[model samples]
Target chain A: AQTVTQSQPEMSVQEAETVTLSCTYDTSESNYYLFWYKQPPSRQMILVIRQEAYKQQNATENRFSVNFQKAAKSFSLKISDSQLGDTAMYFCAFMNIGGSQGNLIFGKGTKLSVKP
Target chain B: EPEVTQTPSHQVTQMGQEVILRCVPISNHLYFYWYRQILGQKVEFLVSFYNNEISEKSEIFDDQFSVERPDGSNFTLKIRSTKLEDSAMYFCASIPPGLAGEQFFGPGTRLTVL
Candidate 1:
């Protein structure tokens, strides 16, 4: 069984600054996918960024990026030039590349607040 | 952008009553899933469906819970006997066939069992 852990319960960043949210997972599977999802007050879950375990390079999308360290079993999300709209509950997820569809294991989540 | 749609954004039912939540996945998606998140808790995977059959399920998806695709357009989750612990936000998600597909999620239905 794979378990994702988000050690930071809450994080705050000033507008236009940068912040990093930490996440770690325990998985024996060599081939897997990691992801970060955002949920606003609307309760809609949105994909922020994803990283393939085999890919040594980190994944970056707009202002969102991930620091994926396969050896350490760590995948952290970094939001650069943060804005108020980025405030939300962020969750880290993991999925096996070998198994069935859409079976993602998620972390408890980190509530991020972008203060102006 | 294509998305998954869940009906009855909110559902309120008494304990021991039956409740059904509906979802519509992307038109071309091949995989469907159901997940739940209790208030202030982690999102937990319940079940996954593909090819009109259950592909995977979690311990949380006990005999009390059932999933069905009665028609081409609608997928449903039924709780035979609701409990107070079942109060949570249920999200429907889908993923298209491919190696690197991302699961798109619906807005979620807030189920309140009193």
Candidate 2:
């Protein structure tokens, strides 16, 4: 069994500033993947970024990045130059590398609000 | 770009009634999944279907729940007897072959059981 935890229930950031959302997981499997998803008011879950356990190098999108600490079982998402559009519910998810089914286990999610 | 789509954006049904949620996965996807999220809770995986059969399912997916791909393009999740606890947003997701862990999600269907 795998579990993902997002300790922060809510977060706020000023426009153009940076914010980091925390995430932790419990898993016995060594090869796996971590992901950050954003659900805006429209209720669409959008993929933000992804990180592989074997790859020490972090994954970075245009304005989204992750700090993946394999030993610590922590994968946090950092949003740079935050915009109002970034305000959404952010979730951390985990999945095994290879298997017949690749269902994602998601965290409780952190609600983020970006203010001007 | 191709994306997963779910029909009946919102559904309200009485307890003990049956409801079927439909999904159109990405055209080239080989694996399909169903997940649900209660209000203010984490998303929980319900079941995964592949090769026209169920590959895996979670404890939350009981006999009351079933999935099928009756046609080549449409995937469906059926709840035989809806309970009040079944009120949640049901999401459909899909993954292209060889995409490892990248699963694209649909906009979710909000199910309200009264």
Candidate 3:
């Protein structure tokens, strides 16, 4: 069974600063996909960034990026130039490359606070 | 940009009552899925539907739960009898191409079983 773990339950960063949220997963399949999602107090899950297992290049989206260490099974999200609007619950998710069921397995989530 | 839309942003019902959550995935999408998140808990997968049938489901998706694409546009999840523990935010997502593709999520419906 594949499981995603977000060790950090909460995180805080000053506006204009940077913060990183840690994530790890257990998967036997070599080919898969990793994702970072942000859910605000409204409880809407929004896709932030995605990383393909086969790509050594980490994924970057404007201000959000990922440091994907496949060997260690670590996929961490880094938010640079953090803003107040960035405060939300962040989740790490996993999905198989090819399967009939394309559902994503998500972590417990990390509550992020962007302090001004 | 096209997005998935779910109806009844919030629903409160007595325990043992039946509740149906509806979602309209992107028109071009093929695979649809349902996930739930209990307050302060991880988002858990419930079931996946494709080709108008269930492709897969989790242990949490027991006999009490069923999904249907009754029409060409809408997807629905019906709980035979809602329980207190079933109260959570239900999310509806759809995969644009197929597996290996990114999934787009809906705003989610908060189900409160009282």
Docking class of 1: medium
Better of 1 and 2 by DockQ: 2
Estimate the overall C-alpha local distance difference test score of candidate 1: 0.93
Evaluated at residue B82, the lDDT of candidate 1 is: 99
- The residue-level lDDT of candidate 2 at A44 comes to 87
Candidate 1 clashing pairs, residues 3+ apart or interchain = none
| List of chain A TM-scores, every candidate | 0.97, 0.97, 0.97
lDDT of 2 by residue, B1-114 (tens): 888999999999999999999999999899999999998888999999999999999999999999999999999999998999999999999998975778999999999999
User: By summed lDDT, which 10 consecutive residues of candidate 2 chain B come out lowest?
Assistant: B94-103
Model 1, B1-114: lDDT tens digits are: 777899999999999999999999998887899999999999999999988999999999999999999999799999999999999999999888774558899999999999
lDDT by residue (A16-68, candidate 1, tens digit) is 99999999999889989999999998879999998988899999999999999
- Work out the TM-score per prediction: 0.98, 0.98, 0.98
> Candidate 3 chain A: worst 10 consecutive residues by lDDT?
A96-105
Model 2 TM-score? 0.98
lDDT value, residue A49 of candidate 3: 95
Give model 3's TM-score versus the native structure: 0.98
Query: For all the candidates, what are their Cα RMSDs to the real structure?
Result: 0.9, 1.0, 0.9
DockQ of each: 0.77, 0.81, 0.81
